[model samples]
Structures are given as structure tokens and as C-alpha cells.
Target: MHAVLPVAKPIRELHDLRPSDLGPGILASTEPVVLRGLVAAWPMVAAACASADAADAYLRRFYRDATVNAMLGPPEIDGRFFYNENLDGFNFAPVRVRLDKVLDELGRYRGVEHQPAIYVGSTTIDTCLPGFHDENRIDLGGRDALGSIWIGNRTRIAAHYDLPDNLACVVAGRRRFTLFPPQQVSNLYIGPLDLTPAGQAISLVDFLQPDLERFPRFALAMEHALAVDLAPGDALFIPSMWWHHIQALEDFNVLVNYWWRQSPDYMDTPMNALMHALMSVRDLPPEQRKAWQALFRHYVFEADEDTFAHIPPAARRALAPMDGDSVRSIRAQLLKRMNR
Candidate 1:
């Protein structure tokens, strides 16, 4: 039997929102907010509301025989995509298949008691469904957002954090989002950073049946959990680095999401620095590690004009304000050293 989890606090909701209401302030918010009926008027949502078959047909109209990457798992996995028992690999196998064929397979499994989990995740909307965005779209206030679509049947994604801010719109079926603040990282029992089911490291705790005995810290994380259910036409804004576990609640589900990073494109991902720190600092002797920590605090974490006040401006080549050129130079220098 699965252990019952504590009820999560409901997410804040904004009613009567329009596409234009997604301004800079909302996009920059650190908290998650639900925009009810934001995409409810979309034609795709109308088709989905009419029937699953109608929704499939509407999606087929835009699919130009494109092959998409899909994750397939047996009934035994119970639609939860995760690592196998050994944690060496994933429970589901990834396959490239026709988008229409996936829709057909989903249609075939309709109403079945125990259906296989079929998920087509993170497919670029413009690449696969060329003109779909023309009819159905959201304005992100000129932010260069990458639009992606997720099609699946009754699946649960492990709790994970993304570097980019997200605006997720539900076009078909219903989805439940369980969210935790970025500060809850220590309590989440995150899996191996280098080895992950998806691109990002995910929480090891299973939401459906949490093994609290093994992951006792998860109980503390649950205390800070906030959740919300989103139906067709509803949208949710998730800020960068907030951990979220998503479940496609119905048999047929389609979600369109846009991701945009607040930082410049030239800036390297912080994950690189984290990996480097693990190699260079984590295993250091205790006293040296403490000394390095103080150095990092002075130079990186709590850096300001005073940090380089002793040095001449011309001599502080790296310490001065950084730009595209300086970033490239630093990256090249790091690469040269690491390759040694």
C-alpha cells in the first residue's frame, strides 16, 4: 500500500486573465501562479473538450508526418517514468516513431484497464507542428521563448528543476502540479547529478508511493509543497529552479509550454560550475575546504566593488564586469587548463 501524503497548499490563481496579462512582472515572479481559463478559448482546447478523437484529429492536421522521440513503458511501471530498480538506467525505452502512429496507439488503448505508458515529450512545436502556433499562441512580452509540446497518456514525471522560467498551458485532459521552493533542495533527496533520467537531476522520492522510511527528509519537503490542478485552457507560470512534479491526470493529455531564461544566452549553465566544484573542492582536506569556502564567499557569492578595490582597474581583467568577449576568454582559458 502507498503511504498517504499530507495535503498540499493550493497554488495562487489569477482569473479572467488574457494573453497580454502575462507581462514582465508575472514572468519574473519567483512564485508559481495559476492563470485559469488563459488558453480555454483556444481551438485545440475546444476540440479536446468535444472528444479525445477530435483532439487527435486537430493535432494530426498540423503534423506533417514528423517522427518524434517517445518514451514507452509497460503497464507494470504504472505510468511513473523513473530509473529501474538498480538505478543504472531508465524504466522506459525511448523510441522514434511517427506522431500520428503515437496518437493511433493512444487511441487503441483508450478505455483499457491497464494501458502502456506512451509519452511524446519536449518536441519542438514549430519543428513538428509547423502552423499550430499560428492559431494557438501566448504572448510572452517579447521574451525569446522556446515552445514545446508534451503528448502522453496518464503519466507522472519525477520532480525536477529547470533553469529556464516556464509557462505551461494545458490544451487537453487535466494535469496536477506539485511544487516545492528552490530552498527545499536538501530535503528532496535528489538523485545523482551526473546521471539523471531526464536532462536535469530529479527527486528520487516517488510521489504516488513515497518511501518515507528510506527518504525521511522528504517529509520536511512535503511540508512546504504547494499543488494545483490545471484543466484544459488553464496555464501555470513556474519560475526558474522551483522543483515541480507533474502528472497527466487523464488518459489523453496535451500540454504546450514555453521556456525562457532570464540570463543572457552567452552565459554558461551553472551546472558546469557545480560539476567542477565537485571535482576540485568537494574532496579537499577539511581546513583547505573551509579556506576555499571563505574565498568563494569573498569573490563569487558576496562579490561587489569592494572585492577588487585593492587592485588597479586595468589589472582586474577577470574581476571587472563581464561581457560576451570576457565570457568567451574565460571559457577558453578554463578549457585550455582542463584539457591539460
Candidate 2:
């Protein structure tokens, strides 16, 4: 069961969640997790720079000097506007400057200096860059090679899932992210691959303003949506396939992130296929729609205790003792269906 909570600032504190706390079969909160003091020892923090100052400097550099490539996509139409679904291609360039130099310049406003930007790639960055865990620290942990940064002004990225799970760290300014569960593609009104309009670049959420009349279903989406404000040193982990909308809060806001897919293939398709099937088969069939609607109420909405009561001991044993193979197989199926 879900409770309606007033929207508030993102969580700034960090706490570990045991597997027990998460329970089984339930997903993590779709809301952003704020981890405070997570990056207290970061090189920038050691310089005693204000979050905004560090962010501004970092973002200015990223936007001004980073090399960027245009993302390609097919276009499509929704309600009225056409949308382009191109993803930006960028190259990550390693920085040769000292951290002290970068931090020092973070405080000053250098006017209109246009240095040729470097395109930074994701692979060069440290995987542990986003982790606050002691075991994942640099030297003892791993080094961050993330050399490039992305600076999109009014620009937007299309709706596509990332292979790597992303931990976005905001350094220079604030960004607003509109996210949807991977399962909500139908409700999202995704653009077509054949053709797309210009304004529908990265978001299905009407940015100009919500047209409640045309997109009434969006009201229901609001219930499922969560927004997070990212400040300096604050990082947000967007688990793979979770739809997201990212926007710069200021003209010079900058952010850096580390992305890597978990091993053995980080994808699922069967679940996606099942969802597609259900939407078409069950929802389209008026009679079955009502029946499955009740089923969803019992299992998802009401959480009826009787639903799993008949599980045999053998079945429970297998289900309870889940392993990597089971996870892989499930995810693989979901990924397969999604690609289709």
C-alpha cells in the first residue's frame, strides 16, 4: 500500500539498508536517496569550497570546453508536438591540471573564455567514485578516470535506458530529474523511432506546463513520480532502465557521474514482455481487465495475506533460495522483451 506524502527536499542523509529492510520482490524507493557527508573527504571538499562555487567552476569548464557529439534518433508524434529521440554522444578527456588549480579557479568568474572542450568518456572514470564505502575508496579502492563532463543547457536527452547503473554527482549547480518506473512506458507516451518532434527531446512530462486536459493520465503519473534536488557532493543512483528526465537548474550548472553495468549482462526482458502482454491482453480485454484489476488489487494494492498462502514447501524453498542464475534468467527475459 502507498501513502501520499507531501513533496519535500531530497534526502541528504545516508544509511545502509539491509536486505531484510528491503524485503523480497519489492523494489527500492523510486525516490532519490540523499547521502549526506557521503563525500566529505572528496578532494574538492578538502579544499573547503562551497558546493555552489565548486559546481559553477566545474560546469563552466564542462560546458565551455568539453567536446560533444550529436545523438541520432528517429522522430515521432505525440498529442501535437513532434519529438526527437537522439542521445548525445560525448568523448571523455582526462584532465591534466592539478586539483588545487581547478579548485582555486572555482571561485573566480572568468569571462567568456572559450577553450576547445574535450569529450570525456565514461569508462575512464573510477567506478568507486560514487561510492562512499570505505572499502571502495581510491588508493585502497579504485581511481576515477572520468575525464569528460556533459553540459547541456536547454538541451534534452531522449528516453532510453543506460547499460550502466548511474550514480550522478552534481558539483556546480542544481538539476531537476523527472523519472518513471521502467514499467511505465505505455503511460509515458514514448516517441517513435521513425520520426520525432523537436521539443519532445528528453521528457514525456510536459515541461512548458502540464496540460491536464490532454494528458489527464499524467495526474496518475504524478503520484508515481519523485523529484530530487541535487546539490554539490550529492549523488543520485538511477538504477538501470528507470526512465529519467535531467535538466540544468542554472545556466552554468555542471554534473559528473560514473556509470557501469553490473557483470554477466545488466538487462531484463521477460518482465518487460510480460508487462507488454498484460497491457495488451488483459487491459484490452474488458472482462479480463476487470478480473486482473481485482488481482492487482489483491496482490499489489491490498497485499492480501492469502495470495501466497498456498505456496508449497518445495516451491518456497526454491523461491526463497534465489541465486544469480535466477536473477539473470529473469532479467534476460525482461531485456529480450524490451528490445522487441
Whole-model lDDT for model 1 versus the true structure? Answer: 0.93
Instruction: Quote the lDDT for 71 in model 2.
Output: 24
Q: Give lDDT: candidate 1, residue 240.
A: 98
Provide backbone clash counts, one per model. Answer: 1, 36
lDDT of each candidate versus the true structure: 0.93, 0.44
Tell me model 2's lDDT, rounded to 2 decimals. Answer: 0.44
As for candidate 1, its clashing pairs are 40-233
Cα lDDT tens digits, model 1, 1-340, are 3466678899999999887678877899999999999998889999999999999999999989899999999999999999999988999999999999999999999889899999999999999999998989788989999999999999999999999999999999999999999999999999989888768999999888889889887888998999999999999999999999999998999999999999998999999999999999999999999999999999899999999999999899989988899999999999999999
Model 1 Cα shift for residue 17 (angstroms): 0.7
Q: Write the per-residue lDDT of candidate 2 for residues 24-112, one digit (tens) a residue.
A: 12123344455434444455433324645554443333222222232221121111122323423212223444332333332332322
lDDT over C-alpha atoms for residue 93 of model 1 = 95
Q: Which candidate comes out best when scored by TM-score?
A: 1
